[model samples]
Target: MTFTPHILESALLLLATFLIGCAIGFVLRRFLAKPSKLVSTKAEAPVGAKPQKKVAAASPTKAAPAKKGARPAARKQTPPQSDSAESQAIDAGTEEDDLKKISGIGPKLENELKASGILTYAQIAGWSARTIDEMDAKLNARGRIKRDDWVRQAKALNKAKASA
Candidate 1:
């Protein structure tokens, strides 16, 4: 039932044979085998081979200038005309110090107000409830009427103008 030297010798011999087989397999894989089909067909380009030059594109020819007899196209650069009656009215007001001096009044509004016949501070101060209502209606119809407080501002501006 005890272990014997012969069994140990047999085990050592099997181990040595297995190691030799592995070494032989490693040597075959490294040197003796053919290259894979995926690799064997593709060859590296020669280092001294000349690279192909890319062709430059030809430049496009310019068109000849138009003849002198031809009429030049007229540029239509008219300033935008407001169709809004209130804006037109506001724009027509005078260049007076009081009318133009109002904070929100601009050149266009001044012109419109002038066109509407609201020319002076006295005219603004003289505006009756009916006149204001009418102006308001015209302004509202135009859709470009300013803030509702414009009348008050205009009135104040007119008062300031009169006192000065």
Candidate 2:
């Protein structure tokens, strides 16, 4: 084939365009990618690593000064009676029930429940209508608790445990 300057120029331009595009992609991948922090509160420690005890801070630190146009840092609202009181009840030597035994609760849901301080069938059994709504919202259950009748199951389970 005869070497035509027009075809050669077109091929050269295409190659140059491809190389520029690849260089831009490499730069973007290197500089724009960010490492995300884990959203889960309970992260598993590495194997053979000793668990660190959490030391309570003597006093709360003051909030940092906010910049103009910057939104305030979101504060985690403490759950009312459900979390605090239930955790206290567990701390008082109440044996934690196998929450997974209840219908519709799996290992993941049980972990979420435990994270929210739900430790006993008694706690699930004693949920009021308002508390159920609160828990549904907290767990993002969207009425699963009510639909699954976890309270009824918990009551029966607790009673069975008592009898045995």
Candidate 3:
């Protein structure tokens, strides 16, 4: 209550504390920045004799802390039916058809089918009993394939294409 005489001293002390805090924060930030990758010069060796190993980029000594309220990296997406249909037609490299021709297969359903590696009628027509279950699960169709007889329609379409 009687610091009027020492007002200047109190102000100086406060200023020093703030300056020290700022300096410490700056140093910490500098130390935390990612280090630049090091590249070795290749001119010392013969031009075309043999290539030399690159200086391995150093890993961070400390893992970067996750930011507050930030989400983790998204999970990697797998190709549809990769496990079951690897031999089916994920990369059949054949001409795709308008799956929308099927009664229940709308544009959205067609896209879902395409995303699940069902491009041609032949692929759908060839679905095995096990494959039907897997595809049904993937599409969340609630057994719509069985209900709508998509296999029969696909077989018909496949036959028509073969005839043409």
Candidate 4:
């Protein structure tokens, strides 16, 4: 039962299990292989890609028509009409074309009183019809300063601007 040194010790234990499975597949392909530019779980983004346009803002230019006694002066104090002109450009001394001398102000309620800081006619003649019905119940304005009939229409336009 010695057949040529037991087939040379079973061919040296099958060449030491194929050289220990090629030295454990060359040390797991030199530490778990991977990285020949392969991080692609699919998001490289150029196959017909078309998503990025946003740029459009440039319109304001038209000015030149306000003079007649260059008006604006009648504000004898009482100012703070609920803080609006972007809530802090609070000069409120009056401008934004003095909200077109209020026969019921326009241009979208003068951009909703310059977006709520009531830009001027001396802060809508220092408001107070319960602060123009709490800014016409928070900007649904439309009642055109009917903030409960704006303090008797701002005391009849300040008694017709103090008898003109």
For 21-131, candidate 4 gives per-residue lDDT tens digits of 999999999999985875669544321234689987765666566789898669788865433223234554534544544666558766866656555444455654455
Whole-model lDDT for model 1 versus the true structure?
Answer: 0.60
Point out where model 3 deviates above 4 Å.
1-83, 90-93
The 10-residue segment of model 2 with minimum total lDDT is 80-89
Best by the lDDT measure: 2
How many residue-pair clashes does candidate 3 contain? Answer: 0
Q: lDDT per model, in order? A: 0.60, 0.80, 0.78, 0.60
lDDT of 3 by residue, 26-90 (tens): 99989997888889865343111245678977789867988999999899987754335324654
Arranged by TM-score with the best first, the candidates are 2, 3, 1, 4
Error of 2 at 65 (Å): 44
Estimate TM-scores for all models.
0.33, 0.49, 0.47, 0.24
The candidate, 3 or 4, that scores higher on lDDT is: 3
What is candidate 4's local distance difference test score? 0.60
lDDT of 1 at 41: 69
Clashes of each: 21, 0, 0, 3
- What ranking emerges by lDDT with the best candidate at the front? 2, 3, 1, 4
Candidate 1: tens digits of C-alpha lDDT, residues 30-128: 898998767566653422224588997866676567898999889999975433322223344355544666555678767766666567655555554
